[model samples]
Target: MAGNESETAQRLIKAFQQFRKTGRNEKKIAGFNPSEYRVLFLIQRANENNSEMKVSEISQKLRVTPPTVTQIINGLEKDGYIERTVNPEDRRAVRISLTEAGLKATEQARKTFNETILGLIDYLGEKDSEQLAELLFKVHDYFNQLDNQ
Candidate 1:
């Protein structure tokens, strides 16, 4: 890249690093960390589709290993947020679904998260927020493609 390009890239990198740090310090939603919230939401979403999620399905969707998914599932289970059932058709497979508490927690977290995001959009104004979202998605896609290659 040219001199100007290099400087701009450096600034962008620094800005993103700052954002990551800020995110790390942000409060957990509804007493759940990001991963836990995601898992609960995934299970709830699957329930809405008239199905339950398997650990492998959650693992694949989260882009994490089975062990990591299992760890999260274990914690959620112990917390009474989720339940595991034997997949009748395939006795070897386990299906996961949210308990009432889990569903309630997930819904509250989702509501709060969306409200926060909507407030950000309001603060940024519609046009700027839209542009920022599009730009972020492009950045994500660029990295995703690079990783694939």
Candidate 2:
């Protein structure tokens, strides 16, 4: 049983590495990397809840440190994808929002990402894709539980 578990773990690790490599290559061809798209997605989601998002809020949602969030925001701001303003309620807090360009770029990125995933689903078939999603969710939940502990 222990040997079987070891083999399973090795296979999972290899699969993840290959998936990441493929994702990175695809993102490169698509113009925006996964991390950039994720930041854009998070900001867009936050805007649905409120007009602006705080840097700390983004950090929390992305599961990254404030500094990391700030770094990404800096790049996005430089690219004209996002704008930062002083929070009206808190003088020290900075609020972030997507610019018109940011929104457009995010929309394009989302469309491309969805198409790519749909292609993968077609390749995997409906049943296999469903099973993969369930397994992935179970893996995520297991790690989340470990983190809480």
**Best candidate (score: lDDT):** 1
Across 1-149, the per-residue lDDT of candidate 1 in tens digits comes to 59999999999999999998888545688799889888999999999999879888999999999999999999999999999999889998888888899888999999988998999999999999999999999999999999999
Model 2 agreement with the true structure over 31-75: per-residue lDDT tens digits: 667667888888998887886677788788878898988888899
Off by over 4 Å in 2: 1-10, 20-29
Local distance difference test, each candidate: 0.91, 0.85
10 residues in a row with least lDDT, candidate 2: 23-32
Q: Could you tally the backbone clashes for each prediction?
A: 0, 0
Model 1 Cα shift for residue 136 (angstroms): 0.8
Which number leads on TM-score? Answer: 1
